[model samples]
Target: MARNKYDVDEVLEDKFDVNQLKRLLAYLIPYRKRFVSVGFMMLSASAFTMLIPQFFQKVMDVCIPNKDMKGIAFYSFLTLLAAFYSAFSLRYKIKYTNQIGQQIIHDMRYDIFEHLQELPFSYYDDRPHGKIQVRVVNYVNSISDLLSNGILNTITDLCNLVFIIVFMLILNVRLTLVCLCGLPILAIVIVVIKKKQRTAWQVQSNKQSNLNAYIAESINGIRVTQSFVREDVNSGIFNNLSGSYRKSWMRAVMFNFTMGPSIDIISIITTAAIYVLGVSWMINGETGITVGVLVAFTAYIGRFWAPINTLAGFYNSLLTAISYLERIFETIDEPVVVKDREDAVEMPPIHGDVAFDHVTFSYEPGVPILKDVSFHANQGQSFAVVGPTGAGKTTLVNLLSRFYNVDSGRILIDGIDIAGVTIRSLRKQMGVMMQDSFIFSGTIMDNIRYGNFSATDEEVIRAAKTVCAHDFIMEMENGYQTQVNERGSRLSAGQRQLISFARALLADPKILILDEATSSIDTETEIILQKGLNELLKGRTSFIIAHRLSTIKNSSCIMYVDKGTILEKGTHDELMAQKGEYYKLYMSQYASLM
Candidate 1:
């Protein structure tokens, strides 16, 4: 397996780009109605909240000073109405924002899932399973928070700030102007901290993803680690990744933790200045501002700073959320390399005549895996490929199914170029059994039915019988209803192979490809599978990548592959008589079996 190469610094730097954040926010456009409702509720709350100080001014200036009990009662009732409105507005804002947030999360998760489905096989090969999983889960969740709470709260806070400032100025311009002197400084500080924290948090998030990928790889390959006795080495690597994550987190936290308190300290100093100046002016009879008005101004000053401080605290979360959005957007933006061509047509059902017309392929440019590998299998013919490991035998099967497109030349199914055919239509006519069989976590019946979802119970049983797997399946405790544990851990390798054979048999495809299907089985089971396979191969164009020499001895033709090309091609008897590459390979393998 190739080692993963991921750089935390590169991923982090990419996260801070403004374009990435803007694109992520664009997902919220479809939920504009909910956002509008939430905005209205926020505005209403701010309006009512701003009225409270004016109500206090009213009670002091007109009601209490006049000694008019009726006037005081009326003013108090109006204050109560404002409080009710504020409470009602808050309720609506909470309900709408939360609904909008959850809906955006749902849509984003679905979009990521759909994109993953459309991505090519090469994408998976180049990326780690754990990394992809972390991107899907962590990145999407972060984006959800960004859309729901971060953006919504930022908008509300800004609205509240505007309303508070306007009302404060209306009450006493001198006091408001004095308090506003600190606003520019606070804004500058927030901008600086936001920039620093964005970079730090992006680094932290990348480290987290890298760490998650490492952990996933370690856990999935624990068996290999244990067998190799390299647990301590693996632990050291994990510790190093986790340490990097921790250091990055602390760096981000250092900047973020200072923002809220720093803003509050500035607000406090501004408030103290206002109190001292107002008191001196009143004592000197230098202004018309009353003590009550000064006190209300102080309250409004606090309200002004409150939103700023809250927004400052939200900076860290915003950066983290944006980092997640960047990761998700990266995945969504990955080009689909194997998509159907615009004019691609649905392939007709196969009569099993497959032709490889100078088919050359390479996953990477300038490094070909199959070099001009041309061959043909007529209807009802069994062709065998004999090659050493890494001789591109399995690559041949992969090309036939269009798992990876060829770099040069073309493959034809019954004279129709595969490149012009819809992938679904092309794959539907084939049945493939890999060297390592995979049984999903489900009942035996379900596993077999996976080959043909619409297969009846009778059809499933018949398929199993055809593959000689029915007897063993019936002997199990729950028979066909038996549950296979994860990856069929509960079953022996041979049993899993038998079940896999049944699955392919159920599909009854015209074209069949078996890549070392019976190699893992015991001798007795292999013999049994051989009998079933002979019957299955009667009327299909089968390509077998055989490990056991006996299996390919009766094939219609045997192609000896070497260094990505066929060195020799002939029937088993003809090749044996030639005493060439095929003869040497067969004799060596036969000697091992003996």
Candidate 2:
């Protein structure tokens, strides 16, 4: 297997980008009303909370001092009303915010998936499946809590903090000023610690993505590992990945743990100073500072620090989310390398005259794959391409399907340049069957119908029978309804190939491409499959890439490709008569059989 060339873990820079955020907020436009409703409820809840301290101050300074029972009862009832308002407003705020958050996630996930579909094959060629899976599943999910509760809670904290300061000043400017003496130090600590936490979290996110990629690759290739008896070696690799994740997480935790203590120490020293100053004012008779006023001041200080602590914690959460947000936005912003032109038109139902007009192409710069290649397959003709491995045979067929665009020249079907037509229309008329057929998790009947969703039960059965898969399928316990499991692991390679053939035949596509479709099957199965393939190729232009020269000997035209160019083109006998590259390949296969 080729080593994965992609670097899955990239260090993040610019923990926050306002432009990326503005783009993300576009998904929430549809839910603006819900956001508005949540904002209002959040502010109402904060206001009601602010009223609680005032009630406490009044009861301490007035009701208790007067020994007034009615006053105490009235204040208690008012406090109860404030509590009720706070609770209900918070309930609605949480409900609305969560609704909006879920909606945004849904939209964002859908858009990411759609964008993945539109991305070119080359994009996936170098990337790992696990990294993409993490972005779509885990990274996208990471933002849910931040969007739903974090934003509104942060707003509420700020409101409470501001209202507390205003109330503290009205109560006693001197005490309030004394209580906030440590404010500058607290602010600086929070800013410094939060920056460190954000960088730590970025490292953690990278570690997480790397771990996920490893697990996905390991699971997908478990058979190879087991065959090679490398379980211990693989396990050691997994341990290393998991250990990195743990180390990063703990490093982040260290920063998180230190924050609470640092804030608390500052808060404690500030509270002690307030007491010392207020008591001295009373003892010296320098001010009318009663016990009630002193108690209220202490209570107000607690109120002020509570939001400060809460905001600090909220900032921690926001920093962590920013890392994931950067990754999510990066994926959504990826450009679709293959897209239709502005004036491209839908392809009419094709007559399947495929022509490669002196096409040249390369997967990467300075390394050409197909060099000035050209060919034509008239409607209803069978063209066979035989080549050594990596000779660009597959690339040729891929160009015809428009899976990748050419560097120069054009591919035309019935005199229409494929690039000039819409991708959906171009692909709809083509049916492709590969050697390693990808069988999705579904019943055999459903898999066949995947070729043509509108195909009926009878049509599906007919297609299977034509490919000689019906007999073996019926031998199974569930007949057509037998489950294939993931990648058709339950079926033999030959059976999978037959099912793929049946699927292609069912589509009745105008052009059919079979890339070594018979390579996996035994000779007996290939003979049966060949008969069905002959019938299927009767009315459609077909291209076959085969190593078994005998299977394509009767094709209308044969091309021998090598090193990014066509070395020979003629009927099989015509090439054999020339006794060149085609003759040598055919004779080599014939000699092997003997």
Candidate 3:
């Protein structure tokens, strides 16, 4: 599979449908009441802001000229009231907007996470861990600013512009026309800058995502890098990534920085023209042209151009935001392809009988991983699968877990077709111990309890003792309260495997699977694990996949797999006596073990 790049630059140049954003906004439909309240508060704030200039006009023209104390007091009080209303309206809008933003993030994050969980194993196989991490954290965070401040500010700015334009026209239509003359040129400049800014911003975003992915991959592989002494080489690569990110960021900044000054120059030229025209009208003794009106008109001109400038800037931000919104929506909109069918029934308690009838599967079309595979294990039977690497041993266990459905054929448990059963119930009866045992950052006791969250302390201890993990766990600095660190980094690989074994044992599953479960352990630990395994597999149907033949030499049936086909099946002794593929593989490993 090809690697995916989070390069924002490339993503930004690609066209995105506006319909996706419309659909994303539909998630806020249930919060319309809050939206309405926020809108009202924003409008109220704008109205009060527009009223402030009118009051200044009154104080200058009417109150000062009349020297009327009562009128001055009343207008001053009205100004104070308007200020309070503006402050209150701002407070309400800010509070509500934050709530709306957080709610949207909460919903979007959950939707993305749940969708990820529902995606098939094949989907994960094709996707990198770093890319998924970027989607969950960085991509989700970017949208919060868009939903909260960006949306609210865009709406408020539009309303303010409309009100200011109408009020200015009402004051003097001729002067309003002069002030508005620069708008068309301003609008054209804004459109050009916005397009360039969007492209640049996209590039920057992509670079940042790539850098993040690189960092995540490097950190996770620190042990390998150290062992190979590739620190200098890795640093050089990191420097290259950082350099590319910085260059992209500089390009975006250049475009954004040009916008404010270009708009300001236009505003300056228009203001000069307005001054010349307004002074000429005054000299000609145009009726109703007061000094106060001229001053207020200039103030309105300032207000007009400021928003025009802000609108230009906002246009660029909106494009960046839209890009982010598209990425976030893409993840949430991914289809849940592994959902249960409407007619699928909840599975009953299992009897440990598992059968695969002529099963066939492939991760990709026309490339079979398991072909015409048939197997049966009666209740309490121990079945072992031995194979060369890439012989579909682990794939068989994945099929039994229904992580991937068969391309052709069916699996049955307790005489019921697994396809007809709900996945949740079907998986509930199985316990798995994989080669790379995952231990979360928590106490040993807490990790064991993860297998069955409802298990009591006594049950947890019993399970630990069954896996011979209790003694080592108790010797830890804080016993059951000891922190494991991320991925159990503080523990040896063998110790981590023991904890995972205890966890699986605690679950008390009817069927058990061990995939190279003791491959990392020393001889002494493997012997202890083997004894515990004997006890654990006594009454449960078990499927063990092992590269080490000694581990499964006593199983009820041993199957040798080669190139996605079952080459032989019989008791271990019988396979040795046959002197075929199994015999050759066992003899090769037996000679090496000596």
lDDT of 2 by residue, 521-548 (tens): 8999888878888889998999999999
Model 1 misplaced stretches (Cα beyond 4 Å): 1-17, 286-288, 592-594
Cα lDDT of model 3 by residue, 1-594, tens digit = 233543323333235687877876786787878887888887887777787677778878998999987888987898898888888988888888888988888888888898888877776775556667777888778778667666667777788889999988877888888888887887787677777787777777677777887888899899999999999999998898899989988998898778788888888998898789888988999865677778778888887877777676666666766656666666666556566889999999999998999999998889999999998889999999998999999999988988888998889999898888988898888999988899998788899999799999999988888888888999999887888987899999989988998988988999999998788778787777788889999899999998878889989999998888899999999999999999999889878667
Decide which is better by lDDT, 1 or 3.
1
Q: Cα lDDT of all candidates, in order?
A: 0.83, 0.85, 0.82
Per-residue error (Å), model 2, residue 91: 2.8
TM-scores for the candidates: 0.93, 0.95, 0.94
* Model 3 lowest lDDT segment of ten: 5-14
Q: After superposition, how far is residue 353 of candidate 1 from its true place, in Å?
A: 1.5
lDDT of 1 at 588: 89
lDDT of 1 by residue, 1-594 (tens): 233444333342243478876776777899888788778877777787787777777778777888888977887887788888888877887777778888888887888889999887788887667777877787777666667777877888998898888888887888888998998887787777777777777788778878888888888688799999999998899889999999998998898787777777888899899999999987888655886688678879889988887777566677667767777777887778787899999999889888999989888889998999888889999999988999999998988998888988989889999999999898888999998789999999999989799999999998888877899999999999998887788898888988898888888899999988888778787777788889999899999998787888889999999789999999999999999999999888787666
Better candidate number, 1 or 3, judged by TM-score: 3
TM-score of 2: 0.95
